[model samples]
Target: MDGDYVIGGVFSFHYYMHTVKHNYTTMPEPLSCAGSINSRGLRFSRAMVFAIEQINNSTKLLPGIKLGYEIYDSCASVSVAVNVAFQLSGGLDPVFNTGDKCSQSGMVLAVVGASGSTRSISMSRIIGPFNIPQRVADVIRRSTAKVVVAFISTGDMKILLEELSRKPSPPRQWIGSESWVTDRDMLRFSFLAGAIGFGIEKSVIPGLRDFLLDLSPSKVADSPLLTMFWEEAFNCRLVKSEATDRSVCDGTEDIKTLRAHTLTHLISTSNH
Candidate 1:
């Protein structure tokens, strides 16, 4: 509030359907589970809308400036996002307008979910043809808000790093908790450095494991071996050589600076 006005924009694409199944090789296997997206998209959209509202209502970083959101139902359709971008660049029609309080005003676009490499590449390419203003284009290009936390697996992280490496400017900075990394994913940390080869200015890895463990050690401990692997991988450098709490691994100070810089860039460029 006392500083720059930050416009928090959240844009998300929806998946219309998901199918799940299980097999029992020893016994008669039955197709067990399937989830439909008819209600899923709406539910996810509502949650996102509510989150933006809550953040704007409560957060100090953007006291006067409100959180804005746009929910585009890719509806599992790549064409829709592409079309939406074209339409938004010209300005929103009355039918699409959500009113003054909403973040969907004007054509300034922010993207959220691009579930996989293919979708990400498609969406990025679709927007590439548009001649959006530099600030707006920068926001769209550099955004990583919708990163798939679950898919932060070694394979996906490798793909992301490779993509970032090819960018001309790369991102100015990246921020994430160290817990986001794992032994198998150490390449991601190194990849962040490689992104610097492409021109990323800084990378900040926050350490949130202690905070998370403090809240629910049992639940976290119950998670798969991958979780521990990632925690240990990230903690290796930060943790005390002998102790387990890994207090030494905390990277809060560095994260704060990176966050400030990221927020500043977001606020400065958002209205463009």
Candidate 2:
């Protein structure tokens, strides 16, 4: 989507950045993300896009203007989020050819969705000075308590859970904040079986289900990110199969036929 004014969004779409070893040799390669995509993060990002599109389509809201967005993946790292914040703030200049006409680029009107408390804090330090409004951290371990309570977002909670999963600890009762209490990703942890918390009441957004299901391979041909998302969700490949074992998608897969658990929140609610 493109508009007269652009907004920025940052989310922990990936759990971590691919590790790189710097030998103080040549310039390091650009950072890449690893780990399975975070569904909750994806949901938050799509909601933003959906809302923006809705506003753009309405005649009564910002009648003559359109809104665009530049979304970045934080990779669940404070450094990555801060780096993206700089880009959103126009701190990094874009390079252009001497032969090409250059003009001032569009700046983001505001930013939304940092996805985690620590990432939000780190990002605010960079964009706050510019008057950008933003919408929306860690620890644990070595303690002897039989129970643990976490008030952090799902991104931070995932990191904590990973650390705790690596070691043998007593069966501890877990208390989660609304952020992660109802997150499907958190449910994968057997240790959180007895966890208790309240999630914000879910809201219904009429036609949102159709909005998500209406995606087509041709519609997202230019975006590798969306293509990857389609592949992951449908368990098929849109691009040429690099591996002999992979299944190439036919582009006719019906999203409506997908199991309820495959995209429950995405199809049923606007909750984050």
Candidate 3:
């Protein structure tokens, strides 16, 4: 989205980043991120966009002035976050000519995200020198602390949950950050029952459900990100089947069946 002043955001959309082998003799391959998508991050990004649209349409806030944003998927890597920070700051490419249109619009008024502690710190360093304003851990096992306060993102918390799920630990009360406490996926662990934490207050945003369900294979045709999300959400291919592999998506598949409450989370919210 574009406006008079643009905000920058970085989120770990993917949990794993593919490691590329670089033979010093040849040009290195670009970083590739592969693995499960982070539905929380996707939800947060969408929320940001939704808020921006609301602000843009308001008659009072920033009246007559537009607000824009540029959001990036860090792929859960600090290096990628730093790279995007530079991009947001217009540090990656320096333009000497005054006629360059990109140089004027490239700089962001402020940067909003990069969820984890490490990634957020790295982004601060890159954008800090330019005086760009910003807004914006764990443990466990072993000892005998019955109360645990977790301050990690959903992706990082999943690792800890998997490790703990393998063995039996004495009942511990968990206090989670907003990131994982209300997450529907985290509830499946069963062991996390009775865990308590603060979550964003549930509220209805008019038209949000319809806006999210408004998707089709044709809309995702040019975007690889959306294609991946589409395949994961509907569990079907948008293309013709090869007779022996995954089934192709038929036009008859209805997204409305996924339930409005669940659709807010995007990819991982439903079993369908």
Candidate 4:
């Protein structure tokens, strides 16, 4: 009559079948990595928590059954992630609860922020120890979830695309907004095409300027690109505004002067 189940052990055929029938998919559940507060991973975690709550409240799943979750703050650190894994395996305190059940059925980890190739490799190495069971390890190693999105202007897009090309299994999709770049950036377009060759199924570029045009200046400026991209991608232009000249080149002379001064200072320091 015991409802508790201890995983990571050999199971009888009957028990295996019973658990299989009730369990979610066998994939290693996604986990989020973020700071303790004010992080994108935290927001994602909140949404997941809300969904589970709704499901349990409405009895959407098995009548009396409910979903359980455990959160670990990676602090965006691989060391923290490894430590978290150990803590979870040891039945440490959970961030959220599901009635009387204590441990989570599985883990969902998230990786946020960006890193270069070297940093990515280091992170992969840090998490390598936990990548046991060759099958699961292989999936994690080959997963595209670790890839990053770069939006630092079209010039930087070429470098990012080149890096992606070097990956064994490149991203399967590219999502961005029209404001991400100018049409003249052929390298960016070509990179999208190349990603498709490496299993990239689709590329999505959102149209956000049209939507922002109608919103108040403050609101438009405050919106995150990710949120704006989601909203304006589907031809939803809820804002209207008059066009005005707003170009970075307007202060080109000042920038040039600053650069010249910086170089002069550097040269003088070196001479001394």
C-alpha local distance difference test of each model: 0.37, 0.71, 0.69, 0.34
Output the better candidate (1/3) by lDDT: 3
Question: Per TM-score, what order, best first?
Answer: 2, 3, 1, 4
Name model 2 segments beyond 4 Å from true: 91-104, 127-147, 168-173, 184-194
Residues 1-272, candidate 4, lDDT per residue (tens digit)?
01122222110101001111325557643343321122233233433444455556675564666445554344433334444445445554443222343434443333322222222333445454343333232453367574433333222344344555555344344443332333234443443522211212333223221222233324433434223322232223324334423222221122122344332321221121
Model 4 whole-model lDDT (C-alpha atoms): 0.34
Q: Which ten residues in a row have the lowest lDDT in candidate 4?
A: 9-18
- Model 3, which residues run further than 4 Å from truth? 20-28, 58-60, 91-105, 127-146, 161-173, 184-194, 239-250, 259-264, 267-272
Cα TM-score of candidate 2: 0.81
lDDT of 1 by residue, 13-131 (tens): 23321222425456533211122222223333434444555567676755666545444444343344455455445555454443353433455435555433434565667653232
| Model 2 residue 152 CA deviation in Å | 1.3
Q: lDDT, candidate 2, residue 261? A: 78
lDDT of 2 by residue, 150-234 (tens): 7888777877777667764567688888888777677777755378887777677876767877777787565666676777778
Winner by lDDT between candidate 2 and candidate 1: 2
User: Which run of 10 residues does model 1 get worst, by summed lDDT?
Assistant: 1-10
Give TM per candidate. 0.32, 0.81, 0.69, 0.28
- State candidate 4's TM-score: 0.28
